[model samples]
Target: MKKILMSACFLGQKVRYDGQDSLLEHPLIQQWKEEGHIVPFCPEVAGGLPTPRHPAEITTRHPVMVVNLIGEDVTPQFLQGAELAVEKAKEVGACCALLKSRSPSCGNRETYNGNFDGTLVPGSGVTAAELQRHGIPVFNERELDQLVEFMTMQEADVA
Candidate 1:
């Protein structure tokens, strides 16, 4: 059986920066859970950052560039968390990740801007980038349908 990495918040965990949960209760996630494919995780929590911590954003020219906009430097902690996430994925035999978009730690393709102006931009979160680097396909919450399709195709191929 194949496994998938999931954002803890999306799974109803209160690990968001504001100490709240995203709680995206969707049929697709429920289906995946029934199929035993979820491996929930929160990279920020794994990195030792407490809930309700300062929300940081990428401040570099691109997502690939490592720079923090809220403070001096948090790149190392992010990287460490990313590594740990990847390790956990490996341990669980997960080949894909469903991340919380707009987060500095889990956003796959879009994240919040540090300007605090409620603006969004193209970017990959730290853990998302690391998972991509390791060949783990990462998707945002809205992309659950595509993920389900992809997983179905993979299952078909295997069978």
Candidate 2:
């Protein structure tokens, strides 16, 4: 069975910056759980950030850096986590990841800006960017079914 990389928060884990999860309870995730094809991960946590971490956003720079509202640079940790997530995905031969939306580490599109203001910009997160660079398709909770369908197509191709 083809395994999928997943954001731990979506798996009902309290790994978010606020120590809470944005649970989607999507059926495809449940199905994947039943099949044991889910590889739950949190790039932010994996990068050494605390569970109740200071919320960070992508900085306005050439190579975006993750910074908290207090303007502390956490880019190395985010990059580390992203790289580790990629390694894990490769280790399990996962071709796709169901990531969190609007997260600094796992967002697939439109993450928060680094200004600490309530705003959004079009872009992928650190982990999402890494996964995409490695050719792993990344999806948010809203795209769970599409991910399932895409995975199904991949399986069919292998068959």
Tell me how many clashing residue pairs each candidate has.
Answer: 0, 0
Query: For model 1, how does the per-residue alpha-carbon lDDT over 1-21 read when each residue is reduced to its tens digit?
Result: 489999999888999878999
Q: Rate the local accuracy (lDDT) of all candidates.
A: 0.83, 0.88
Measured with C-alpha atoms, the lDDT of residue 65 in candidate 1 is: 38
How does candidate 1 fare on TM-score? Answer: 0.90
What candidate 1 gets wrong by more than 4 Å, as runs, is 61-72
In Å, residue 127's CA in model 1 sits off its true spot by 0.7
Count of clashes in candidate 2: 0
Identify the leading candidate in terms of lDDT.
2
CA shift of 54, model 1, Å: 1.3
lDDT of 2 by residue, 1-159 (tens): 689999999888999989998776867678879999999999988999998988899986468678886778999999999999999999999979999988888889878877778789898999999999899999998786798789889999999
Compute each candidate's TM-score over C-alphas: 0.90, 0.95
